[model samples]
Target chain A: MSTPLLEAQGVRFSYDGRTPVLPGTDFALREGDFVGLIGPNGAGKSTLLHVLSGWLRPSAGKVRLAGRPLRDYTARDLALHIAVVLQREEHTFAFNVLDLVLMGRFAHGAGTLGFESEADRGIALEALAQVGLEGFENRRASELSGGEYQRLAIARALAQQSPILLLDEPTASLDLAHQRHLYSLLDRLNREEGRTILVVSHDINAAAAWCRELALLQCGEVVRRGGPRELLRPEVLEEAYGVPVAVGELEGGQPLVAVRR
Target chain B: MSSPTPDRSQARRTALWWALLAVAWLLVLGLAPLAGAAEISLPRALGFGVPEGEFNPDAQILFHSRLPRVLFALVAGGLLALSGAVYQAILRNDLADPYVLGVSGGAGFGALLVLTLAPAAVVAFLLPAAAFAIAAAAVLLIYGMSRWRGPHTPPATFLLAGITLNLLFGAGILLTQYLSDPYQTFRMIRWLMGGVDVGSYRVVAFVAGVGGAASLVIVWRARHLDLLSLGEQTAHHLGVPVASTRRLALFGASLVAAVVVAYAGPIGFVGLIVPHLLRLVVGPDNRVLLVACLLGGGVFLALCDTLARTVLAPTELPVGVVTAFTGAPFFLWLLFRKV
Candidate 1:
């Protein structure tokens, strides 16, 4: 219907000129959509995310964001439009949670290298609050637990205030409760805030329960793409994951998937 | 979560750090010239008023010797520290310094080359220019080597490349020393030890001019340095032009290191120690950290030079020796403390 917020057509990527990871891949995201990218290990899910966010260039074809070629946007302009929550970074520097979060405001600020204005500070604080890390602003990032750090990372992207958010394996280190919290937060941002979100997760049940659509990546290709109901069927998942996964349902008819013995 | 609130406390704390460091720096500036061999009143040395009973020779000593030496220490220390901080940030390692990137080694080689080739009368001009050129070249070589794996020079590769370059330059200097005559060898040895024994104001002016320009460039890019600490990809996502920023930072920092090494003969530890110490006091914000390093580094090196001149009372150990003696202990303690 409307122009897709982002689209990749026949995109191919390789590492060190080896075999292509995303060989002949095609994907699209609509505005305000919650999409989950679920794949088995080494299926190039993270690589695809990097390609979409312009962190990595595809060897063939191109990615278009907001009807513009991804390469057409400078890093600054692209950052202003797309916020990325990377996997848990190492505690290399002694930046506090607030400092890390405020970094998200880098692209949105006015001058060449703008200082954090009062308004920027307010937005950063609000973002921290949104992630329930308000009082933890003064805490060192090194001091944060894995789940708290993930939340802080999310807070940083929230502070970016971009229209689109891309997260890679956000729930990998998170506990059950934090995972639920993160999923709900992503859902709320997608629905209430009208932010388009593409989250990569290995948790199929969680992906089915939360995301409006799921894209199953098998090896390097988007093998199946549809709503949870259509993609969570046993035959499709079995083909993609190469595991006999039992696809069942919750009390509310949400899909539940478990690996068959 | 509580209502959104500005971090007034952090802001106030940073302000307090600035005020305190500024005041302490001014005090060091006043007292630095007084700690040398001859006694000179702080007021008289600062040119506030001539003391009624002050001797002309002591005043002459203050003006001719101590004053220039102190000024040189302040400027050179500030430059070295700023260079160290920049290297540490761009290279993302605590051990990254001018010496690590072979700047000091290349500079040392340049100085020895001047001694071996240029006449004594024209050495003052030739030495610094040659050193600066060679040091910059060495850094460029290091950067080139680090970029072997595509565009992104990973921190580990960068550090290893620097170490390799340092060894290569170090061998060159050693060869130069071996080839020189006894008198030239003596001069090279003294220069390599790194000292702050300024005999004239001209050297002071040269260092201060270059150091001031370099510090300004660094402060202007301090915000980028802050973003860079997040690592390249994250910083890129945050809109920093990582490649250009890396290039500019390397050029600016290497220029400061080369010029200071040219003038001061590769004074040790001020660059490495000042930033490490100040980061603990002022958090990791580069805006504050860089400025604080400028002042704190100046004071630290000035104080160390004072001790170098006075501790042995006319024996005059090289300022580098004093710095290593002091810095080595702190560095070891820091390592053991695991901070």
Candidate 2:
């Protein structure tokens, strides 16, 4: 009923001329929706997310955010409204976590290339607190464990104060406990903070358990889009993945998935 | 798991260490002019009434010659160090320096060309401006070549282009050297040696003015420099205009390096060594690292110049030679330690 917070109207892209990565893809998101994008390798899930976040431009069609075309917003303007957490952390310099988090406010104000004001520092500390990193702000980022680094990145995104969050494989390298913690954090942001989140993941069970709606992509096309109950069925997943998978339920009534022998 | 809070007392202690280092640097720079070939009284040096004695040529020599040279070394050293720190942060490579990117070679070639072609042109102001223009052109050419395909010039590709340009310009310098007569050859050699005979007060003021202004601009952009330390993609996602910011940084650093190289004739190693050493002491926050580099470089070069004059007695070794001898070994140590 309400205008979608983000919309992709027939987006298409190709790295090389002949082979298309995303073929005429159309998608939209409403406010506070937790959407999971799951697909096999080469399904262009990451490309779709990149386009939505304005990191990539589509060969054809348009991507609009908050009813404005992506091109209408400067990179800084877009960044103020959307935050992307990439998969790998490859920083060459050693910066303390608090300084790194404070960088999220770079697009906000004016103080010598937009210095960190008191309000900016307050927001950074609050974001760190949200990600359970309140006291680790003085630690060097290079010294962080993989899970701690991921949390720090989420904290940075939170400091951006963006309404839209895009995460690429947030749990891929995380341990089990960290993975659960990350999922709960995402859920909290989406439900309580009213942030729209779109996650690209390979973990089907995590997707089925946490996402209200899931889109199954195969060969650069959405094969199925529905509630998790419908999309997690054995037949639909087997079609998308091209492998036999058993879909079952746990005692808490969440969907569980496993590869069939 | 609970995270450990940073101890306030420890942070205060770290600040105190920085303050002590700053004071030590100032002391070294202040006292260096006194240690030259001549012996001047502390009272005379401090402008106290001169001792009731014959006109001390020693004090005159110290005031007129060594003090200005020492001042040149201090300012140029700080400029080179700050430029190096900015370059390393912007390029996201520790080995990156304004000189290494062919700027020094281009500037040298430009100055030589001007000196050879227009022998009558005033050497004071025109020479340095010509050198800066040529060096900036070389940077723009490299940047253009790297970006012919797209807006983004990846760090690896830019570094490769810079290395190639450096070699090409270095060869050009050799050609210029070979084609010249004995008079030209002697002048070029002296220039290459990076001595501090800056001729007059006007030159010193010019260098200090430019270096001082550019350093302030860089310090103001310290926050952006921090964002840039994260790889370009991450910086972009965090709202940095990676391409434009990088270009601006290179341009600013080039201006600073060109000014110093023009005045001092391409002093070696102060840029590379000062930033590297400072980074080891104070982590990689550019805000702190840049300031430390300015202080450390000024002190280090001032001390080295003192040694250059006093160590060889009547015959002074070129400060550049001392810097290379000191810097090359430290660079080797860094590589091995990093490995």
Candidate 3:
């Protein structure tokens, strides 16, 4: 078997160096895999994402990207590989969507003189088009609706054109239609572009429908890792979410899951 | 993905605006020397043609007094505004100013100490140098105190530490004034009120060189400043050396602001208002914003000084008072406006 694109062996991270948020968890992602990491609130899903993205350092063990230690990569070198869309951001001044999206090209050497090259601008425009924000180039970022802003964030990540994309609750504020739109976009990137995607979400049904693989985490550890059909079983989800859930089938024969309550 | 064609008009528009401002600045510089108590003919004062005979006092006043003063205002104001632009970006606070970081307070205290303690012949250059050293030290101290949160100190914490230091330095200056004799106390008061009476060409050259160098450093790092506006975490993720960039920006901004305060005392509100007003005109692109502020600040303080010294004829108001008088109303208007 080919080596995984990313691997975390016994990775442990703690904010205060005492009770670890990610207590020696082992995880791996093969190239071009669409993986969903889902769990209840405070399950260290975001912490794990941070550790994987180099935002936070693990207290023990190590994470490797492309078979090399993640810590060995410089920030720019790492940025050339992974693009991240954080859960929240607060900007003091308003930037137009074009300007904000163009920032994604920074690591790619787009804004060295604060002027966007033609190629950089082209890439930004294409990324905005991918996010269905082609006409939003002039709109102020701070003035966007919740869903639009989320899409803009995704567009920025897309502009990075990195091989790996990591998202933390990207659809938290998105409506159902917008959420479906975002997943479709991610699906295209994974299948057509052959990019690796890792998403942290609480939406188990959506995760099962979209992600090729699911890792169910509970209390800083993955309780189960398998295909969505295997991990979305009622017994497995109940153990992770601490709630009764039912697994069923749609008329189209696709697996369906919902909370029992 | 298909390649796109970027619109070139925005760049053209920005260049046009800068060119207009440059022309306006030249006009201001030309007329500035003609406005003071002793009126010199605009053409003759500018040394257009040689005078017929005798000692020309108007030429002396133009060369010795008005010219250096005008140049001083331009350089000093430009430095303050440039510093303000950097501070606002690094702190991620629109209200952040050069004085908000305690640079002026520390430099003011340092200059006051020299003025009160040093003998009559302390030389013009040593005072500003002392002030710059102390201001730079104050910045390092604030950064140290605020670094309880690992290598990166968040902007809010840094701002709080700066305010606390500003108050402490203000108290130190007050105590010094209490200990000084009457004549020294009077001199300290005038200096604290801030003066741009840059009588010597040598002082103008020094301010211009130092201020120009600091502005150049900021302009060179304009890209980093743009990233910094997105907050440190986002900037870091975009490959900015967040801690190092923040340190360099803070030092450069503080050094520039201190240079102005060291010589001119602490001119108020030019740093605070110039960038704020320019943002409304040019938007938040720091590359263009910093350049605009650099030129606009020079124009602003030069004009304000002209009005301050000319409006009262023989009695000149403190330049700080002129800035505050004009800036406070505009600030109030901005607060109520949609911007």
Candidate 4:
């Protein structure tokens, strides 16, 4: 098999020294893959994402991106290759929508601090339009709705123009319709643009409907990893989640999951 | 790599800001000397058709006395406001200033120590040097304390250390004032009030030389400060070299504050007021705001110093006193105003 675009080898992490958050976790993502990471709380999903994104270092192992050790790349070089959408962001300076999005071009620009090029601004505008925020250029971030802000963040990451995108609970604050739009957007980005995406989400049905691959995490380990058809069976999910879950099919044969009450 | 051409509108916006700042500088530098306690003829101060070697008191007052004092206020105000803006951005605290970090307190203590203990003749030289050294030491102490535990010095840690240092240094200044004799106590009071009284062109030169170098370093990091203000982790995610930028910013702010304080006493509120007010007017893009702080801050102090001398002619109020009067109301308004 070709080398995985992003691979974590026996990665282990902890907030404090004594307890392990990711105890010898291993994971990998291939090029052009749209994968969903689903796990209950305290399952180390966010910790693994942090490790992969170079925000946190693994105590026992290392992550590699495109066959190079993650440690070998500087933060700027990493940002040029990977863009991330975090669960939370801060906007204390009242930067406008365009200004916030243009920051994605920070690594791309040659200016020392924040002088974005005309081309960079054009690209940022394009990204904002891509995320359906075309007219929000002048608005302050504080004025945006929660869903719009999430899309705004994605727009900013899109301006990074990176091949790999990682998101952690991107739809946590989003309403149902917004979540649906976000999932469809991700699916389109994955299918049409052939971007590699790994989203950590709690929406199992949404993941099963859109993601080509699903990984079930529990106790800092990927217990079941496969195509949705192979991994969405009732017994598989029941074991991974420690609860009985009903797995049914829609008219399109996509898996629909619900707690068996 | 070749530098990309800046966005057309952004470039235009920045240029407009620069032009406005230039106009402000010219107006302040021109009119401030005129409104002082002693008036001077503009033509004489401009040195138009005056005999080359003649000693004219009007010209002398303009060039040697009034202009130097005005210029000193400009540089000193610029440094305080610039340092405040840098502190506000880097520390992610709007209230953060050189005074908040105890830099001004250390400087006040240093000046009083020199006034009380140093020989009379050497005081002109000793006062500024001692203040600069001691103020710089206080900032270093705060900087070092914040980073002692880990690689990252969270803004909270930095502000906590600064607040603690402020308390310690404030007590030291009070003790010095208490120990001094009546004559020295009078001198100490003047230093504590923070004024624009210039002794020589040398002190102005000293402040401009050191403070100008520090200002360049701070302004150069303006872009990074924008990202860093978001949060360190996000800044790192966006590819800012967070540690180096923080280090350089702190160094620049501390040096600028110490030098200005040494030369002009611990002039308060210019740092707090100028940057905050400009941010409201121009938005908080540090590229524009930091530069604005330099020019606008100088103009502000010069005007306030003009008020100081003119408001109670012959009995000059301290420049700090004027700023405090202006800033306290602004601070209260900030607390009460609707967002």
Candidate 5:
């Protein structure tokens, strides 16, 4: 009955105004919910995440956080609420891990003079530990392996200490083991820390196995919202992906998906 | 979470390295003036126990000639390096310098225009102000050119725009030189070759006040700049007011570079190499790099200026040549090392 932590009401968006990417899709993330938004390429999953993160404006309708329109919040105010893990993270410079993660404390009024406080360092270290990067404070960010860099991104988000997290294809470049490990980290953050999460992923099996709920997006519209068992049906996925799809059940009761080709 | 004692210790060690650089900077400032063509005894230069009349030419050689030139180089070089750190952060390219971006050329063009037309009485007063105006406008021009792609323009786009402006500005400078008569053309060439013949402390104070204050503005927002260097989207998510901070830092950095160009002509490469070299010593955190570049660059240019005068006795090379010798190769390595 409580107001959703993040809500999109008929949100429509487009990089170009003439063509809408999110054609009035609707979605919501309640507190403590771990939700995956899975769709084919160009389905507007990342675009919708951008809309929700307030990085992009919706062409129509509105996104609300804590029952208020998202546009009402300043960047700092929005940052105080939602931490984001953007897609295609790049570290071209050699900023050490600790300094990079301490950037998360910026919105918290800690890095005003560029010197973070002891408390800020403590929190950044804790966030690193949460992502299993406990001893990576001095390592160069640009040199990290794919898995460590991905987790470093999460550590930066966690250092924000926000109640809601929005990640866009965090595991796109990750190996299978690292993907599952990142998902487990997300799961712990959701169940134990009581944070709300919405992730956009192309990997359906990974999403189905890890996310507590799944939303299926097709042609810029979120058309199905349910347990993975319901939405992973051959017909639903076949329509979304524009291919014949096969579905099975895992021994753990998670859905298994394969393209008919 | 484990304690980050090592990080804290490393932070302390980095502070020490910067501190050592500061000491070295002071030493360079003190010793550079003594190395010029005409030697002035230290006691006489300091006017120790000497009457005012006795201090005329000897003390003038030190206090009026060499010391002013050295201080001018220090302030100008410091501002250039400070702005270079800022441009690298905002432009997101370590190879990007105000000189390469035509910021200095634009400022120099504005000063050239004033020197050509302005009354000799007020040229000093009008120079840096005009320079800052044109330099800031040049930055706007680059930002506008890059914005056609999007709000988040790729680094290459702006760099391309800037390099184009630098080329065009170079043409403008050449045309200005061609129009002036022989005496005026020679004077223009002297300034163009980058003279630090600052005769008074007032000019040094003026450059430091304007440029040093602008450097402070960028240094104060160093964290915001570091986040921005991570990428605008990432910085925005981390709570940086991306647009406003970028604007202010750009203004501050350009102003600092403008002050330097207004006072000292096209002294190239101090800005380009100082920050790049110091980034190796301390990491790319602008909080440290910005300040380090300030001191490190002042020392670098002062030493180079000293060598300019002393390297070939009785015949001084232009300071720009010395800097180019060191910086051009380093810049080439940065550009082609991975190739």
Candidate 6:
């Protein structure tokens, strides 16, 4: 069997010692896997993502990426391999889109005292184009709409050209049309480019449409891990969310999730 | 990514405008010495050779005293503005200025301590340098104390620490003042008022050396500074050594301010206002903003000094007073505009 592209073994974490946010969670991702992490609020989905991306250290266990311990890699080294799109985008200072995207190339060769090279700019432009923001490069990031800003964040990650992309609710604030568009883009990225994509979303429909694999977490522990078909059952959804959920098939042959009234 | 070709035509236009502005400012700075109470003629002011008779008294005064004062003002003003720009970029705080991190207060306390306790041994150059070094240390200490739980220090915590340190240093300054002699008190008052009358070339060269070196260091790190505005965590994710880069940038800014304060005695508001003014004109890219602040600050201070000298004629007002007067109104305008 091929080695897992990313693995978390017996991971545990807590902001305060009393209630653990993540308790001995073991997870793994193979290459080109489109995984969706679904859980209610405070279920440790974002925490798990932070651990997997090497942004946060697991208290009890270890994370390994590409067969190497995650802690051994510097933040920049990890950035060149894994890109994370955080939930909120904020900057105290305003930056134009082109300049913001170009920051992703900072690790490749741009030193602290160095300027962006031609190659770096090319990657940034290509990333922008991939996200349908080719003409908006000069626009200030602060001026972007919610959907446009989400695309910009994705573009920044794309500019990193990393194999693994971790997005935290990439479509959370986006409209329905933009949501479909973003998932389709993620789908293409995973299928054609063979990128390892992991996304955390509250929308079960979004997970069902794009993710081949699904993991359900509750109270900081993974309760279920399987294909979407197995985890998308009404009972599992009800248990995970503590709300009665009706899972039905749509006319178009897609799974639909609705909270029972 | 391919190299982004900045519009050559636009760049050319910008270059032309910058060149024109620079030349005009230089001419104004040069002619400022000639406009004082004595009114030195243009030919005599520009003359390389002293004429066959006694040196033109007006030209002599202009070249000897007023010219150096104006140069000092220009250098100090430029350094303070550039330092403020660098600090703002590094801290990612729009309100950050060269003195925001308690550097000015720390430097003031240091100089006051030396003046009160060891009056005769207080060397002119050492006063600001000592203050600057202590201020840098204070900043580092505050940062170390405030690192609560995360790799990144929150902006609010940093600001609070700076304010606390400023108050602490202010108290120290009062203590030193109480211990000062009548003679030392008078001198301290004059120094606190900030004068540009550095009567020697060596002082000018020293200020120039410190300010020039610090400015170059800041400009070289301009790209990194731009990335830093996104916050320390993001900058780190993008490969910047956030802690080290921040420390170096802060130190550089403090050094520049320290040198200026050493010569000009804590000239206020140039650091705060020049960066704000340049931001209005050129947008917030540090690479462009920094350069603009440097040139713009020199010109602004030079003009302020000229007004200070010529406004009251024969009896000059302190340039610091002028800067404070101008800076206060501009700051108020900025607050209203931003709101």
lDDT for each residue of candidate 5 in B195-295, tens digit (9 for 90 to 100): 66667899899989988888887888988888988888898898988878987887788778776787777788888888888887787878788888888
Angstrom error of the Cα, residue A250, model 5: value is: 1.7
TM-score of 6: 0.90
RMSD versus native structure for model 4:
3.4
**For candidate 6, lDDT tens digit of each residue in B1-339?**
433455344345446646765786688767777777776676765564656776576666777787887787777778899998888887777788887778777777877766765646556656766766777677667767765546556766777788888889888877777877788877776777776778766777788898899899888878778878877756766666677788789878877887777667777888888888877776676766776777788888888988888899888888889889988998998879852
Q: Lowest-scoring 10 consecutive residues by lDDT in candidate 6 chain A?
A: A109-118
TM-score of chain A of 2: 0.95
lDDT of each: 0.84, 0.81, 0.85, 0.85, 0.83, 0.80
Task: Please list, in the order the candidates appear, how each scores on TM-score for chain B only.
Answer: 0.91, 0.90, 0.94, 0.93, 0.89, 0.88
lDDT value, candidate 2, whole model:
0.81
Q: Which stretches of candidate 4 lie over 4 Å from their true place?
A: A110-114, B1-6, B44-55
**TM-score of predicted chain A against the true chain A, for each candidate:** 0.96, 0.95, 0.97, 0.96, 0.96, 0.96
At residue A60, candidate 1 shows an lDDT of 93
> iRMSD (Å) of candidate 6?
4.5
lDDT of 2 at B293: 78
TM-score (all chains, Cα) for each model: 0.93, 0.90, 0.95, 0.93, 0.93, 0.90
Q: Which residue segments of model 1 deviate by more than 4 Å?
A: A110-115, B1-11, B40-56
Docking class of 6: acceptable
Ranking by lDDT: 4, 3, 1, 5, 2, 6
lDDT of 2 by residue, B252-338 (tens): 787888888877877889998889888888777676677777778888788888889899787888899988888999998987895
User: Can you give the DockQ of every candidate in the order shown?
Assistant: 0.47, 0.45, 0.49, 0.44, 0.56, 0.44
| DockQ winner between candidates 3 and 5 | 5
In angstroms, give how far residue B110 of model 6 lies from its true place.
Answer: 1.5
Which DockQ value does candidate 4 get? 0.44
Predicted structure with the largest TM-score when compared to the true one: 3
Model 1 is docked with a DockQ of 0.47
Model 3 stretches astray by more than 4 angstroms:
B1-5, B46-53, B123-125
- Model 6 residue runs over 4 Å out of place are A16-19, A110-123, A251-253, B1-25, B42-63, B121-126, B147-150, B178-186
10 residues in a row with least lDDT, candidate 2 chain A: A109-118
